[model samples]
Structures are given as structure tokens and as C-alpha cells.
Target: MVSLPEELQAREAAARQRVEELQAEAAELAVRLERARAALSRLEITRETVMEVLADLSAAEVEAHDAPDPRETPAPHGIGVMAVPPWREGLVAGVLPDVYRDIVEIVADAPGPLQAKQIVPRIGLEATTAKIEGTRGKLKRLVERGWLDEDTPGRFTLARHEGDAGHVNSR
Candidate 1:
């Protein structure tokens, strides 16, 4: 080692202090770098797990939501229950079959059960097995709902007269 004067000794001490400050700064930077790497890893894992969970939940929803309406039950009568079609014809004379519209028209003009067979031609409902039976099924529902009453075995007309409408209560 070369001999140094008193003035040079002070400069050498300052150089050692500067080296210590740089060492401390490097240590702090190393700690920050490790924390940043750990945070990045945690975010990657969280993103992958979230994607997997969403995929499973989507699959479950598809399985559960696909189903038919339970209210569409089979009609008790030989004919099946059909939807009450939207009424667009003039005068709200109650729910009547499209084919049986004429039958209702005739009855509204002159009230009575124009027999099942007689109603076919007038209402344009040809006396086919499916058509007749479906109409009969519809008649049964209307009767149950108090919109039609079986005056005789096969003869079904309107629910009841306005005066007797109160007596037509479901048992």
C-alpha cells in the first residue's frame, strides 16, 4: 500500500461511504424485484383459475335451462288441448272454434246447440275424426271453464244465461 497524506485520507474515507450507499441501494432494488415477480405469478394463476371456473359454470347453465313447459298437459278428452286462438272476428261472442265460428254465429243469432254433425258444414269443420275429436276436447275444456255447458249428451252450447250465470259454479 502507498503512504497517503492526511488530506488524501479524508478523500479515501468519503469513497468508502459512497460505496456503502451504492450497496444499500442495490439491496433495496433486489427486494423490490423479487416482490414484483411474485405478484406477476399470483396474477397469472388467478386469471387461469377464474377462466376454468367460468367455463364450468357456463356448461352447468346450458344443462339446467333447456326444458319444456310443464303446463302443456294432455287433454282428458279423446282430443288434445289446443291453444285458444287469437280472436280477430267482429263481436266478442266468447272463445269458439275457428271451424265452429259459424255455429257460434248461428247460435248467437238463434241460441241452441246446432248438433255436432250439423255444425260441421256451417262452420267449415269437415266431420273428420281428428277435427271432430279435437273440437270435442276443446268443448270439454270450455265446459269445465263455464264457457259452455252440455245441455244434452252431445249437444254443447254456451255456458249459461246471464240470469242463471250465478248458478254455474264449479263443484
Candidate 2:
């Protein structure tokens, strides 16, 4: 027959081994959890970028083309394929009066005044009343301030980023 003390010792050893195995698994799981969190953070940033782009496009709806709807309704495609206006990305970022500083950052970061609807979620709108004209008014003011020169009636582009003091030195 097996001795009682030896049997108990073996059982205790088995339990200890099981604990070590569980500890190793826990450490690995911790690593995986950290990796997943990092991936999620990156995805949030991407989502925000996409939202920003979409918001810009929505805000610039005034420049919509006269093209007839290809479909009765637009189908939902995957990411990065949304219909955004290429022309009015500048207006999306902000107009000159309100967004001159912001525009400088966007211009410096981007290749040009791109269809930057990518920044919509990043630049979320706050609650405002009908009297409160935020970015839109700033853009109009910028045209008046000569911070932006009008490419067309609604479309305005920055005259110069710096040293202009919101006035056009020359036409």
C-alpha cells in the first residue's frame, strides 16, 4: 500500500506544478491583452480620422456636383472609399478667419489643400444655436479679412499662411 505521507507529498507537488503552468499562461495572456489594447487604440485613431474626413465632406455639401444619382441610394462601402469632394477640403478644415492657424497646421501636415474630410471626427462640432455661426462664419470673415482670397464665390483659399496679418498685400 502507498504511504499516506508520500501520497500527500505527490499531490502537493502536482498542485504546485499546476500553479506554475497557470502562472505562465497568465503572463502570456497579459502580453496578448496589451497587444490587443494597442491595436484597438490605433483603430480608434483611424476611426477618428475617417470621421473627420466625413464631417468635412458633409460640411462642404454646398459644393455638391450636379451629377445625377447613380443609384437611388448610395450603397455603404467599406472604409476609405466614401464619396468626399476633392475641391472643398480646405473649407472643411476651417475657413480662414476662424481656421487660419488650424489651416496652417493642416497645410504643413498635408501635401496640399486636399479633400481632408479625413479630419471630421477629429474636429468634432460643439453644440451651437442658430445665431452661433462657428467655422462657417469664420470662413466668410476670412474672405472679408483678406486672409483668404476667393477662388470662386463659395470656394476660398488661403492667400498666405504667415506675415499677411489677414490682409492681401496685392491681388
Best by TM-score: 2
Q: Per-residue CA lDDT of candidate 1, range 1-171, in tens?
A: 545686698888899999999999999999999999999999999888877875675466346645332223211222322333222212133333443444445444435674556555555677887777766776666556445568788787765555543321211
Tens-digit lDDT track of model 2 for 62-95:
5567743422333234556542222222222222
Which regions of candidate 2 are displaced past 4 Å?
Answer: 61-78, 83-171
Candidate 2 RMSD to the correct structure? 14.3
lDDT of 2 at 87: 23
Model 1: colliding residue pairs: none
Clashes of each: 0, 9
Window of ten residues with lowest summed lDDT in model 2: 84-93
Estimate the TM-score of every prediction: 0.35, 0.39
So what's the TM-score on candidate 1?
A: 0.35
> Over the full model, what C-alpha lDDT does candidate 2 score relative to the true structure?
0.50
